[model samples]
Target chain A: MIDVIHPSLLLFLGAAIVPLLRGRAQQAWMLLLPAAIIAVVFSLPHGSSGAMNLFGMDLLILRIDALSMVFTSVFAIITFVGALYALHVKDTTQHVAALTYAGSALGVVLAGDLITLYVFWELMVFTSVWLIWCRRNPVSMAAGFRYLIVHALGGVILLAGIILHVMDTGSVAFTAIDPDSAGFYLILIGFMINAAVPPLHAWLTDAYPESTITGAIFLASLTTKTAVYTLIRGFPGTELLVVLGVIMALYGVVYAVLANDIRRLLAYHIISQVGYMVAGVGMGTIMALNGSASHAFTHILYKAVLFMGAGAVIHMTGKAKLTELGGIYRYMPITFLLYMVGGLSISAFPLFSGFVSKTMVVEAAALDGRAWVWLLLSLASAGTFLHTGLKLPWFTFFGQDSGLRPKEAPLNMLLAMGIAAFLCIFIGVFPGWLYAIMPAPVEYNAYSTGHVLWELQLLLFTGLGFFFLLKHVGGEAKISVDTDWLYRWLLPKFALGVQRVVDRVWDAVLGGLMRRLTWLVSSLTHHHGPQGILARTWPTGSMVLWVAVMLAASLLLYYL
Target chain B: MDLGRLLEYLVENARVLRWFAYVVMAGLVVADILIPSAYDRFPWESIGGFGAFYGFISCVLIIVISKALGYLLLYRGEDYYDD
Candidate 1:
């Protein structure tokens, strides 16, 4: 039998073309496509099967094993939720862009070789930026530009690494890359940028808040998490990641603590949560990698729910800043509850999805004999609750009444959040479905009595920590500093300096050229009679004599 | 404001107040006890290397203290960036 092509590709691609159709057809396709893709993603032969060679150098596409399957399944789920969430959106450009964007990420999951991976990788960057640009505002356009510059830098580094990898190895395998050369590190940096690794993470918080309401939700889901998948794939065993991961974790904690914007706070926690995953990847154990991969999988679910809730608030009241929003739960109770689940899940509260997945990464960190990383990871974990879990929902939904009476989110939006909320609880309650599909053996249980008890104790103590440090958490606004300032602010300033130097050189060159032209014209005018020989009126007598002399000379030469 | 009230406010609002300060002093005392000397002609790199976290925490605490000091001493208005 012909290999069952993953239905997601067909459905998304088909929906993409629907934008070209009539209005009724477009809306119909938008509704149908996500469901079709989700069904097809689950209906596949339930095992790894796809090609990995196209041009004799292995065009590696479609490897659907447990590791990738877990990610792909959640990706499909989010794409569905995101699509439903966008059902009321009239912007077909965004709809088409979102489809192609989601499809490219699926292609990445199925991609089994370096070439195919890069192809999907670049497209994910290319198509997703349109969602940002879809906001159709100058602010959004600028945000998209910055977002592209950073991701393009990542893409360039990634491409360079892949080229060197292919040249050195004579094969384009998409497997755990050894530290044979700096190529792996280049590849790691490339992936790390998208993973929101610090010194490179500002593009996320800076641009994500600027995306259109639904656009941010879609923007948040795919690109960074896909890079996380790549890191898990390529740099799993590398030890250096442990240090970088801890820095990222701490950076997220400190910044989230100081952030005043709600979306920015969530954005910071993205880095914080990914820290645990990167540390897990560094640990290199099967359990740890599985944890990282599984956490990456569950993270997208909860994060998308959080974004959806945030998007709903922004949609209803047109407010995203924490200072502008408060007491919205009075109107949007469903979204508020949805957001609470998301917050709890992300904080890793016991019986939520994060509790099951995040603990895996922390356990892996503790097991790796890195006490400092474990301590920081624990602090970051507590900080997650303080910033995102308590701070986000409390500020946006339940804080002092600002008396902004917006309506509840639309039905489609609620449907999306409801589905995501269900998954969050369902996964926490019954992780067997997720565990069975892990890339590694899944003997480590998330729900041991001791594990649950300690997690509660940890969270309870951290709750005390947050309330104790409430003054610190809610202190006067200061930009919690991080390494991203280097690129976002400092590098741009450096670029401005370089640009000034280049502009001076250009001006001097042009000045010289213009002066040289003036000099040449003046010299010609001085040498020639009346004016420059190049553009002058010759005397009639001289012209006639010259023509006559030329004729005479020609005749004389011919005679000779 | 009176001098005592000003000092109390500064101490209460100091970013690195108390906890990190105690840690820093404890660290210095530990170093003093361990080495028994103010300066070594050739100190082991391991000591400094191993002491990086304690030192980093100390520095971070100092910055925090500096911020509170800035508020106390250099309490600029909040509209600094506006103009």
Candidate 2:
């Protein structure tokens, strides 16, 4: 065993003290802590170490494989970026909460056992909520509470699955699982909720957009990435995910098309992009899984870029709805350009990072001879192009010129987006840098002529479709329908109905109970005459009458 | 020319245009099967042709019907949650 602990965890745990110190120390917590933690995480002991026994099976927590390495690197990068984004805030509660959250995610990646993983997993839920509530608005507080309920439910489900899985196979090892048991299925569902899978996707858009600006940036970076990590560990290669993946791909596109809030639109597309990863895992090929990891890594980068662009707009304009905001791109050109690369990357445009990685999943599907899935993927591709690829930037940055002049985003924000933008194109132009670091050996070429041609044709044709239907699809109105409409709308409606029934029942029962008590008391204390027994003194006539009545009863009994 | 005749004249016969467009769509779909792809493989898939055509048609039909009903049943106003 190594002595004095792994350096990353040491630095990360060490940084927890920074926020606790006095004034200047708080700022130091934001700046230096991330720098120190990243350095330490980058220096972890490489390769898979021996698995430690947890529950019953050997657990590999410190596996520095290609798969885990990409996420660990980006996870650390986001902490720094999210810190820079949130540095303006003075709230120590949010600062410490955010740092601990970033540290928890780091620990999860380095964890070797299921118990260790679960420990970090639950820590993530509690800390992330404080970041949201830092906005200190009634709506935000409510949204934070709603987010907590859902996350708590996810934690409970995951805990049950982990416990049952351990008991069943006598193994708490994290690896690919067969979907043959209640435990396995519950765990998949749990991960999918964090993944923002269907009917439950609303919490993401509902909460993230409502949090304080810096709070949103931190909220965007970590939660989904951690969920993607757990999914990669637990449910790689399961067939049912193919169906869920396809549904998410299309669902994101359709809802995104209708969404008016800029961040919510991006949030929907987050689910859409994760579909590529989920489908990749379902394909179960090594290439596909690698592609998923690559996609997740790139997605976090570009998505952060997108959210920052959005945050910049909200920073300046104080508006996020499409109707109220436009033409601000003229004011913030640097931010606009940075955001464009992110958008293009997510759309899987040729030579962008998305094109290089997403194809592997598609190729794996074809290799597996699942033609229907291929068609669904193509349709989702068309939708992605229609909604996010062409629609997001075209309308926001280059649309009917809303003529609203907002100042450029702050220096650090622009710098962060620029860094992400450079990576988007860098990985697109030279995918080898990423390919070199994939979880598996790289043997695939994303530059094939057929592949390039088909993608261009698909994206171009979808763009053509968008122009044709812009009239039907265009409007400033925010459409409030998604998996979220269920919890946000339907759940409350159902609760109101149940409450009405309960109120009526309770009122009737209590009313009857009050009446019966009154009736019983009245009967017990009745007085027959004007002079009651206790009100007047006892007279001689009354005593004599009582004795005469007794004598008469005795004589009557003797005669009988 | 009268208004109807003027419209027809500018469009080159309305019925003729509709029929022409329909014919062209059918032609492209038919050409897909007859023309040899560069790989010498006809991309015409035979995996339950109804699944490609009529299954989709039925699914669309059901959705349209269900959505029409849900529109009336599940409608909520703008301020439902705000208050």
Candidate 3:
């Protein structure tokens, strides 16, 4: 016995006890599990553990390395923050689903074998979808189903890939996969789907905005970040990811400009932000990988803050669309301030957490002499600020007054947001704490005079442009047709059309058969009736005459 | 001080804040000329105020292009998928 306990196990077992307790005890339990998991994750030794042989395959349930540690730490922290944010909720089901979802994500980060990873990967999907359905609305129900179907398909593809890879290599270890391996593209596609790579991404924007307010916080923090971790772990330096990542970075920003729902806009930004991590993994340089890991850690905190702020507004006002929100900053100033911290951090302002981490990836691109990648990424950064930093806040908080005066968010929500806000600033100011835990030693400086000046010029000028185009950038009361339009509209319509054709063919064929069968039945009935010729009384006399004739004919033939 | 009231004050002084923004922008452009980067991998980085010009142009183009794309193909009524 190695005397090690998986952080996921702590959360899983802790969740089992949630229903048995009530009131403050339950809340304390909810908070305590994540706190304890954080401690356990920090204390984990840097090696594989919980090894077992199952069905002739070696399974490592826990793998602790610098890479895994970064993800597990952030996952644990967000679980706690999310718990605090949801403390006031009376529903036990959401609580259980959330804890297990977080744990499953941790299990994914810590998994050391393909089997273990796949098991946790599917568990993540099943557990997280409940967060959407728990909203208890028709839209959420439909969105949850779509979300489930897409992820289930992705999971099947992943399993196929894992099976093929294991068969080809005769190993199940979850390590760097060969690009030429049979399972390579399948597994990458699976991870990319979860990472919200385009054409497979609409499930996120469609479902996440419809999730329960508290649920969106965890939903935002966990699923895609876990996928990023897997990408970093399994498929580093794949050139395809580089192209896909740049597309994702710009793609999300483009959609964000068209989004009306506040959470939906943030959801689009998630795709954009994850693109950075994906690109960093593609770069495969030490600095780039570290940037991906660190960016994920910071992103979880700040993104949670943003969601929390948006959720608070929704919780209080019962409105989620940006067009319907504004001027409540006067009532919920703390929420506004905290949200701006997140917005600024995401925009990579100097002395913010995003500044330190996001720049590393861009710097890596610069160092790699990929001028186009660097420029495109820089352009995306400006767009990030334009939407998340400027447009979102201006519309939601400070734009035309909607005259709705909702109370400040609940105390627990404020405390959760406050903690995340503090961390965003704390990490921004002293990135040394964050950098120390990177998989590679840090050599980048984020606050150099040149860098700060350049970023300021970029961001401030973007703000200038936003002000210039303020009237046009305001949220419109319309939805953007993303790739989900295929499944939601086109696919369903096509299926209906196919069903109509099948119905018409069946009706024509069955109708003809029914008519023929009716005619045959009538003719048989006419012949078999009691009044027919074969049943007449004279039949016996005719039968005798025919028999005599036949006897005579037979006698003649025999004589001949 | 109540943060809300402070924000209200800032909003009331929007003109002054706008000037402040302009001042900061001007200052950053000036600083771009004086403080050269330790490492300039790209030739454009050597140009003074390139960051400002690019940032402004990028922001404007992002807005215009995205909105145009939205109106032309992406944007639909809220009940797009309902039927």
Candidate 4:
């Protein structure tokens, strides 16, 4: 049965074959694979179905519960959208990497055991880094290297935790475990790194913007959200996540505000949006968990739409920095309108997808009686509107006319974006379509009078503040130093200084050894020369006389 | 209606739109007070126009504080890493 085959295996197998098919065959396969996977994903019934015994343990390979289903559905959808967007891209490596990356994420979401999850989790790191590296630029190559190092560290941490967790608990089921154990916390740290929690987060901001245009769409959608899914499955209600999540929510926004590059701005915003999901998971209530899951769902859509828009601009203009791009709407009005849909949706404006999903998390915080979290999250929302909603579009599409008159985005790009833009609005207007598929039953209404008024006043006044400080909010032609600066700049310089000192000491040690060898050679030469006792006629005869004398003495002794 | 022309017209008449926004803001503040809230877990909820003030203040602070920190500690030239 199609249902018997794992959707991820389908994708991996499809990726393996992508290079074989060429031209239109490859394109058809690229588009059809995700659609077929979607069919396979939906055909399977929700529960732990694909179970098999491997060695001593039972590996539950496919668990199609509501939570996994939510993420898996989106993974398939985004892969399709991403493939469509990259239809014009001739790079076979990127297509394969992206498909496999999506497949690995689906594998992560569906894995019913921790080991299964860990396997897919590590696969995600290797496959997704190629999406960045395939850009073939030095900057991307370097960024991809950093990205691999960070995620590999994360993978090691997760594996250590999984080993300890399985040994200690005697179970590998992917369920919420007690956070008191060292193993769980190690796992959490690993998850947090992939989730792009601050300090550990700079890799995301560093590598994502450096990805190929279509690659960023894939990069943006999968890794962190998959981590969020795993968190929901494994660590729902961990209290520390509340604080880290809030800090991440705000930290991302601050960096985003300082970002000059258009894609980097969006990348930082990914951290910010994911922060909301993390906070929801931290709240740990049914409503909050559902909120986090649903928010992940919606965030994937709107964020993808947002990336698609930014990508369209970059694709057209060959410029990614905001300082270098302006008044592009004149040339690409369709792209402009589509991008604004994403912008407004992300800001949680009423009737947008973000409004429905993001508010639920805040509402969950309020319902859980976390007043401070509620306030901070509210502030983050306003900030979200300030930068992504109002600032990004205003500066990029409509701000100072930098007079870049690139042609409109290619039709394939627009078609993919158009699909994403449509979904963003579709879910916005009819959120029940999304809510029905949530991990938990939906009880919250987004359009209550108070909620509407509050969000409206919040977003509207945020708009007011934007216009009030229009000049101040514009992007500068400067790059923002994130936590990656510690490794990217500070660590390398520190290493170089250490190397210089090491080199000097090494040279001195070698010189000292050489001096000693020279002295020993000179002493030996002096002692063995004609002027020395050893250099007497007997010795000067090249030790032959001495050998003859020793032989004679031995023979005399033998005769005696 | 031609959407581009409409958008252009909107952009050109920015001053009037700014005034209109201010008027809307004032009206919303009054409505915020008059319209009873459904959830009042926080004290700020009871305060009329709290959302407006909080939103405006937070947005301003996000921009101001972020820019201050950015200028002070975060930003470098585009070639900062390239070297």
Candidate 5:
């Protein structure tokens, strides 16, 4: 008996039905579906459900706990807002893809077994790629292909790890295990890929900015956070994540500093922000884990706001590069304001969402006596302000006038950004509300005078440096080469060269052989024809003469 | 209702804003020492404006170092991959 319906199933059904509807019905369906999913998520009680025997194995398809619930609730909320932001889109493919992509992420979070999680993990990849493809540009097409290939590789790695894990443990239940085995290491690598840790991160920065305006918002929020969720669930105490997470934290900021495109800059910052959560998970303390969870929840809301604001600018002006945009505040005042909220939240400004959540992670590091980790993370925070908090807005909105007079974003986009912006401030002011839902109890305080003053000094000094080097720090109209350079350029050219050589070899070998065979057949047929010497009536006469000659020779041999 | 005008007013007064920012920076530096800090793992946390100095130096170093690295190796034309 089905006691509780899966939240993801509701989204999947909604996605299926969306394509059949048209115009107003589709729009209403898009809005109402996420709302219904949210309602269902809230109504359902926490426990394991959807368990059954399949092929002599137990499959727990749905698992709800504090960890999964936080992700589900945030996923549902983002879908609703993303739907509202995308209501102006006329393409039904985008609507379906968005809903299904979000649904698959929910499925992943709720999955109680490794096999079930893998199914949803692959679905997340397949569905999310369409958001990039729906842009229907050469860049988007290539990026989407790259995005798909990378995620497919990640999925394979994860599947291999799961198989080995199930074999060794004799169970498929997803639980935390010591990272002392090949299976767990493979699993960690797989999750790290999705988390966009440093060398494996180029796909995210390459693909996200190229997605359709609204699609980028969904792309930013779901995939990496789900990986963080899985990591926390399965490998919380793995110390390697701490090292990689710190590298990612600093690495993302540096790349973002070099980025010229506003959306791409935000995309790089996603790596940096997720790095904080990863570092928290690596710390493996209850406080750090809770911090990672709360940070993910808050990051989703604020990052969505940032993307919405940037998407609004791109949508209205048809400009994305920072060089092409300047003095946009003259036209997009509300967007500028909303984008600032996101910036402050990400920069960990006092009275912002990031300030409330990010501090916990830093405090965890401090409490754990990992002074170097804490220091690096704090430095990365300053860099985050340097690029995302200051550089992005200063260049795009407040820099020299490019003399562009684009109008404000559409009302729906504004409403979406506004909702996200409100949450950034709300969560900042009322920490207990967000803290109450965390997996661990709230013992850390974000509002102590020491924490607030220290945070403010860090942010303000960063801002001070921004103005001092404003001329040099602004982005240029240049692209920063990343690891994607290997596949995007080197490999393709190498493959083409190999293909040319193969074609020549095939022509030489196969063509020459075919010609010889054809010639041989023609020559034989010509020689054996009725008009030819061998095919004439001399065949029977020759046979009798040959027989007589053979008999005479046999008689001579017998006489000898 | 014309938010553009208000924003323009704020933005055009760049000199005033700069001064205001300087004041805030100085005040935070002083407050850092005056306020009784709840937790201090590093000895530098007790120093006045140490955080401010750290933040400023870190931001500048990040930009400068990244910009240097970008120019030396990473920077490429917009179609660097396409070619």
Candidate 6:
């Protein structure tokens, strides 16, 4: 008898039934599934399950441990929250896609083998692409295809690595990989692509803003966090990741400076935020790893809240660009207030969730005697406050009026944001609640006098800089090109160039050959035609005479 | 009180809020000087208001550099991709 049901299984089952039901029943079922999954996840014991010997390889389907439990628990909660925020959406396809996309993400976190992980990884791509496509616009269509292609390429690289890894080790278990192993870099690249490490990160900022308003929340929450989970599980203590992570941290903040779209700005911050988790995974100390895990946990909640707030504004006003918005605080004060909680939490302000988790990694860097890493990470944190905390909210809700006063978000959306905001503050206030669930013992105190004073000084000063430069920081009616420009613009143009050359070559070489062949065919047909000299009415008589002559010659030759 | 009215009230008293921010910032600097941290890992971290200076400078530099980069390489018309 099965004592533990995989949470993903429940979500997948719910997704199938979603399209069959309608109206309030479907909505209730959607909410019920995530709630039940949360219960199931909590009930799950710390061990492997669904073990089987497939083709002489042991396949562990469900591996529950301290690390995975932390990720899955948060994932389940966000699924429920995301579902609630999406309650106003009437599109059943969006509902089904959201559920399955979430289920696949849970599947990835719960997977014990690389094979199982890869299957769910690809499932996540296919199912989640619908969220972008569900917007049903040309831009989304193009963005969705690009998202699909990029992930497909990443999936192929991962599959190649997994095959080689299994060949070298004769095991498919997902664990810490030896760097010198044949598949190490291949697998790392694949994970890094999903992690949205720059150069490999364009797919995220490209497609997310184009996704449907409800879909953007799930899009923001799941994909990269799962990638962080894999990086933590697989490539802990990678020194290269340390460098890459820091670059990612600053890279996102730098790019966010140019983001005009509200969702796109938040999307870049996801990269900035995930950079902290990646850096922690690279540090690889118990404190650092714990920090990474807890950060991912807090991050999922806070980021969901942030996305929900942004989505709410877009939902009501149908405007997503920061340049096109302002003075809506009077119209939507609750959203402004709730969004502030997320902003403060992300900025690591005192008594916020980020303070508890982000500092652990930065502290780990300090303890390790890496001053540059610590300082750079701190700078990135300042940048975080500058963008997500100050610039976004200032221009979006509180800046000079754009003369648009849209109504507040719907009831369900506000409630979802409210729940997430409560968690952010609750975790901020009593970090013990979050600490108890960490993968390791929590020894650090976020409320210590020194840490709080330093954080306040850093964030508040950044706020001052924002006000001073208020004239310059407002969103412009322009976009900043990222790595996507390579594929979206350069690659297509290059392909067209290649196609023109090929066409000319075909015309010169194959076309000439075709002309010759055509002439030969016509010549042969002309000679062999019924009206030709060779095919006249006398052909039968000539044939008989030639046959008789040949017979006589053969008889004379035989006699001789 | 309604949240809108509260916000409106704060906005109307923007001067007071601005002064409040400046005063808090000043207080934080003094606190940093008075209360030395046991957890200061770097030499500069022990300096009063190092964080404040760095935060301000970093914010300014980030804005200047990002704007420069944007103007030089990144910024394009909104329809840059459509073509």
Best by TM-score: 3
DockQ-superior candidate, 1 or 2: 2
Clashing pairs in 2: A61-A111, A61-A112
**Docking level for model 4:** medium
Model 2, A1-560: lDDT tens digits are: 44324534654475567666767667666778777767866776676664555445577656676667788888878878877776666787887788778777766776666676777888888888988898888988988998998889988888898788777767666766657755888788778888887766667877887777776766777787777777887788888788888777766766666567788778878888888888887777887788788888888887888888888888888877776676555577777777778777887888888888877777677767777777677666666666665566666655667777787788878877777778889989999998887878877888875566556555654554555555544434534555556777779999999999999999999989989987776655444334545455678999999999999999999999
Candidate 1 A-chain TM-score = 0.87
Best of the two (3, 5) by DockQ: 3
Residue-level lDDT of model 6, residues A1-560, one tens digit each, is 33578788888888999989889998898789888888888889998888878888777779999889998988888888999998978899999999999999989999999999999999999999999999999999999999999999999999999988989998999999888778999999999999999889999999999999889888888999999999999999998888888999999999889999988999999999899899989989888888889888888888888898888888888888888999899999999999999999999998889989999889889888889889999999999999989898998899989898888889999999999999999999999998898878888888888888889999999999989999999899999999999999899999999999999998899989999999997787788777656665776888999999999999999999
Error of 1 at A482 (Å): 5.1
lDDT by residue (A40-117, candidate 3, tens digit) is: 888899988899999999899999999999999999889999999999998899999999999999999999999999
lDDT winner = 3
DockQ of 6: 0.79
Measured against the true two-chain complex, the DockQ scores of the candidates, in the order shown, are 0.03, 0.04, 0.82, 0.74, 0.80, 0.79
**TM-scores, chain A, per candidate:** 0.87, 0.89, 0.95, 0.94, 0.91, 0.92
TM-score of each: 0.79, 0.82, 0.95, 0.94, 0.92, 0.93
User: Candidate 2: where is the Cα deviation over 4 Å?
Assistant: A3-11, A20-29, A48-61, A178-182, A401-403, A528-560, B1-78
In DockQ, how does model 5 score against the reference complex? 0.80
TM-score of chain B of each: 0.31, 0.41, 0.91, 0.83, 0.86, 0.92
RMSD of each: 11.0, 8.9, 3.8, 4.7, 4.9, 5.2
For every candidate, what is the interface RMSD in angstroms?
Answer: 15.0, 10.8, 0.8, 1.2, 1.0, 0.8
* Model 1 error, position A134 (Å): 0.8
Candidate 1: CAPRI quality band: incorrect
A185-234: candidate 5 lDDT, tens digit per residue: 88888898999998999999999999999998899999999999999999
The sequence of per-residue lDDT tens digits that candidate 1 reaches over residues A233-292 is 888877888888887887777666556667777888888888888888888888789888
- Tens-digit per-residue lDDT, B11-73, candidate 3: 999999999989989998998888776667899988878889989999999999999999999
The ten-residue window of minimal lDDT in model 1 chain A covers A473-482
List, in order, the clash count of every candidate structure. 1, 2, 0, 0, 0, 0
Better of 2 and 6 by lDDT: 6
Q: Which whole-number lDDT from 0 to 100 does residue B63 have in model 5?
A: 87
- The 10 consecutive residues of candidate 6 chain A with the worst lDDT sum are A530-539
